[model samples]
Target: MAFYLVELTKSVTVHPRYFHAKLGDHVIGRLLALTEGTTSGRYGYLIAVVQVERPLPPGRILPGTGHAVFPLRYKALVYRPFLGEVLDGVIASLTRHGVFVAVGPLSVFVSARNVPSDMEFDETEQCFTSVVQGSEDRLEVGTLVRLRIVGMRRDATEIAAVGTLRADYLGVLG
Candidate 1:
């Protein structure tokens, strides 16, 4: 899988289909910057250095535009998809379900099942709280955590993820 940092050249109106697209979603063409038009229509222009995910589409010649670049179906390429991978993430939002860890551009679901049982629910705080859950101090909302990926699935529509604080290195951080 290749990684490309693309700039929005022309303001392309993203269809509803594009909004919910996952992190690994793909795009094609030599992504370009908008010299004139806005990315507000069904289609616009861009200069992208895309890693062709499929055989190059049939090329055509457009007026003014040098080449009629074929629209290539971009395939989402996940660079890292596995357990034990260390990710820099933050506590996005929490619920009875689990804590949502925002790992860079992706969100990781750290389930309650993965949290050490030693951590107890604080009725006052409404969040799972623990004084010493096998870490330096505690586990609570807004606490910086150093977690190890314990489970993950990339094929699913939403990433199935779970983390752990059961190891020497995996736990709450100061």
Candidate 2:
């Protein structure tokens, strides 16, 4: 996965109730609501609003509705991942079954079936653990890990991926 900064122009619509002194803020807020955290094939997942052009553009009110539409140009940070890509992620959550890793804007699932047999779920400790070379290695919440993208699905506002920690150079990180 990778993040990219790009300039984009999006049309943001604001309700009539928000048409006040700070209409610019309202418009930009609406734009952020629509774009941020949303995923598209073209730009992937729009992470954050980087900048908004100064002196907000004029809005055109619709015919039947009183909503104002503004063509806002702005810069944003986006994340798009590819198959077979190796990426570093933090273990957001873990279970006896598997773990959920957050890689940038994408959440990847590392299934237990794909995990190495050397590790096992420690019910008492509530984590995946292993011992090698007289040292203990644990996979728990907040653990840093590296994985390869095995499969992916892009939805309207989300990018779901299935990752594996069994490959070479993959797995727990110190």
Candidate 3:
């Protein structure tokens, strides 16, 4: 699956200066800013802060600096790419080694080997081109392509995937 809905809890710390009447609002604001758009190995990428659970508990305040650490619980929409998934994306960049496709917030790399056998990388032309059925096809930057996710790797802040366009239904799209 490309996207997943998950629940997450995070500790939102409020500084002493902003620890006023509407401290809850401040913490909630911090929560959204910190959690949304972040990626974790376990959670993939946080697409949105779906909703924050209401009636936050009175959090514990650190003694040393008077900073309050509020345990915030909420539901979020996250994007997680899975193996064997077919996704359509725009070609973000083209290189001699591979093509980088921007599939939503994820960057998928389609290496030279994963591309179709008939397509060849032409250094002078700066694209992957092929002649098929009396027509010329070109794969270049900004082209839309459909690829299958063959492998994936997760990092602390992003998810990377290897894609292939060698299948019958995969490759450049209109």
TM-score of each: 0.52, 0.83, 0.94
- Write the number of the candidate with greater lDDT, choosing between 1 and 2: 2
lDDT, residue 46, candidate 1: 22
Best by TM-score: 3
Report the Cα lDDT for residue 59, model 3. Answer: 84
Candidate 3 RMSD to the correct structure: 1.3
Candidate 2 worst ten-residue window by lDDT: 129-138
TM-score of model 2 (CA atoms): 0.83
Winning candidate number (lDDT): 3
Error of 3 at 157 (Å): 2.9
Off by over 4 Å in 3: none
lDDT of 1 by residue, 61-158 (tens): 45664534344443222233356776656677677767877665456777777766767656676677766646445455576776778776554234
Model 2 error, position 122 (Å): 2.4
lDDT per residue (tens digit) for residues 1-174 in model 3: 567778889998889998789888899899989988788988888989988899997889899999889888899998888889999999999987889999988899999999898888999989999846664778899899999999998878778899999999999997
Query: Which of candidates 1 and 2 reaches a greater TM-score?
Result: 2
Better of 2 and 3 by lDDT: 3
**lDDT, model 2, position 52:** 98
Regions more than 4 Å wrong, model 1: 1-67, 70-79, 131-138, 156-158
